[model samples]
Target: MKDAAKLFAYFFAVVIGGALLAPPLFWTAPHFSAFFAKFDFESFFHRALLICALAFLWPLLRSLRLRSFRDLQLDENRHALRDVVAGILLATVPLFVATIALIGTRIFLLKNAVPWNALGAVLAAAIVVP
Candidate 1:
C-alpha cells in the first residue's frame, strides 16, 4: 500500500506539476527564442507539457532505485526499433484506415486545405504528446 501510494503521488506530481508549469513555460518560451513564437499555442503547449513531465523523470527513477535501463528491465534489445515501428503501425493503421473510410463515405469531410507545412510538426506532436 505504501508503494502504491508513493507511485500514485509520483504520477500526480509529474502530471499536475507539468500541467501547472506548462502555462508559464508556454507564455515565456517566445521570449527566450523567436522559434518558439512561431509555433501555434496547441503545439507549443504540448511540447511544454512534455518537457515539464520529462523534468520529473530523473527524480522518479531515482526514487524507484532504477539506476539504469537494465534495473528497470528495459535493457536494449536488438528488436527494439522494429518493435516500436510495429507498435506504431498497429496503433495508427486502423485509425488511418477508418479516417479514410469516413472521408470516402462523406461522414467526415475535409473542410480546409491541408496545411502541408505544419503536417510534420502536428504529426510529431500527436505521436509525442501522449
Candidate 2:
C-alpha cells in the first residue's frame, strides 16, 4: 500500500510536471528554429510533454528500484527484431486496413499533392512518439 501510494504520487508528478513544462517549451521552440515554426503548436506541445514525462520517468523508476529491463520484468529475448516487426505489423495493419476502407467508402479522400519532403519526418515521429 505504501509503494502504491508512492507510485501514484510519482505518476501525478510526471503528468502535472509535463503539463506545466510543455507550454513553455512549445512557446519557446518556434523562436529557436524556422523548422519548429512550421509544425502545429499542438503537435509540438504533445512532443514536449512526452519529453518532459520521460525526464520525470527516470527518477520514478529509480525510486521504485527499477534499474533495468529485468527489474521491470522484461527479460531479454533472442527474437527481438522479429518481435518488433511483428508488433509493428500488428499495430499498423489494422490502421492501414481501416484507412483503405475509409478511402474506399469516400469518408476520406486522398490529397492531390503529397508532401514528399515531410514524409520521412512524419513517419519517424509516428514510429518514435508512441
Candidate 3:
C-alpha cells in the first residue's frame, strides 16, 4: 500500500476503535447519589452511532483524500488470495446469521418484548465485519 493509503488506514482504524470503545457522559442522578440518570434509549444509540460515524468517517474521508478517485488501484495479489477468501467467508456467513437473527428477533418481539435488534447490532456486525 502507498504511504497515504497506509496513513488513512491507520486513521480509520483509530477512529473506528475509539467509536467502538468510547461512550459519552451521561446525566447523573440527583437524588440517588448522582450515579444514575434519565438518559433514554434514543440518547444512547443516537450518540453511539454519531460517535461511530464521526470516528469512522474522519479516517474514511482521510482515506479518500489520500488519493483522488482516478488513482485508486490497490491490488496486492501476491498473498491476497487467502485473505480474500477468509474475508468473503466471514462476511457471507455473518450476513446469513444476521438475517436469521433479525427474523427470529422480529417474531419474538412480536410475541413478547425485546430490544436487542433495535441496537442495530446485526447491522453493525455485518458492515463492520464485512
Candidate 4:
C-alpha cells in the first residue's frame, strides 16, 4: 500500500478501536471527580486517553520524515510574542467587553456567593490548558 494509505488505515483503526473500547475501558476509570462525589471540570481519564491517542499516532507522523521545522513552516517567527499577545487579546477582549456589557445592563447577575473550589478549577484549567 502507499504510505498515505497505510497511514490512513492505521489512523482509522486506532480511532475505531478507541471508540469501541471507550465505554468498557473508562467506565470505572480514575477521575478527579471521585474526590468530590461530583463531576470535576478536570478528569484524569480524559488526559490519559488523550495521551494514549496521541501516542498511537506518533509513529505515523514520524514516518512522514519531513526535513526541517522551517520546511514545514513550524519554525518560530520573529513576531511570535507579538502575535501571541495579539491572538490572546483578540480572543479575550470581546468576551471581556460582552461580560462588562451584560453586567452593566443587568442581563447577567454577578453572584456574590462564589465557590472557592470553582475558582480553583478555573485557575487549574487556565494553567493546564495553556
TM, every model: 0.52, 0.59, 0.26, 0.60
Q: What value of lDDT does candidate 3 attain over all alpha carbons? A: 0.57
* Worst 10 contiguous positions by lDDT, candidate 1: 121-130
lDDT of 1 at 74: 64
**What ranges in model 3 sit over 4 Å off?**
1-36, 66-130
How many clashes show up in model 4?
A: 0
Better structure of 2 and 3 per lDDT: 2
Question: lDDT: which candidate is best?
Answer: 2
Q: Sort by lDDT, best first: what order?
A: 2, 1, 4, 3
What tens-digit string does per-residue lDDT give for candidate 1 at 1-130? 3667767877787667767767787788778766566666666556656775678777777777888777867656889899999999999999999999999999989868877899897785566443
- Please list all clashing residue pairs in model 1, or write none if there are none: none
lDDT values for all models: 0.75, 0.77, 0.57, 0.63
Query: Which predicted model would earn the best TM-score?
Result: 4
Q: How close is candidate 1 to the true structure, as a TM-score?
A: 0.52
Clashes of each: 0, 0, 0, 0
User: How many Å off is the CA of 66 in candidate 4?
Assistant: 4.9
Q: For candidate 2, which ten residues in a row score worst on lDDT?
A: 33-42
Q: Write the per-residue lDDT of candidate 4 for residues 9-35, one digit (tens) a residue.
A: 766766665565555434543344443
Ranking by TM-score: 4, 2, 1, 3
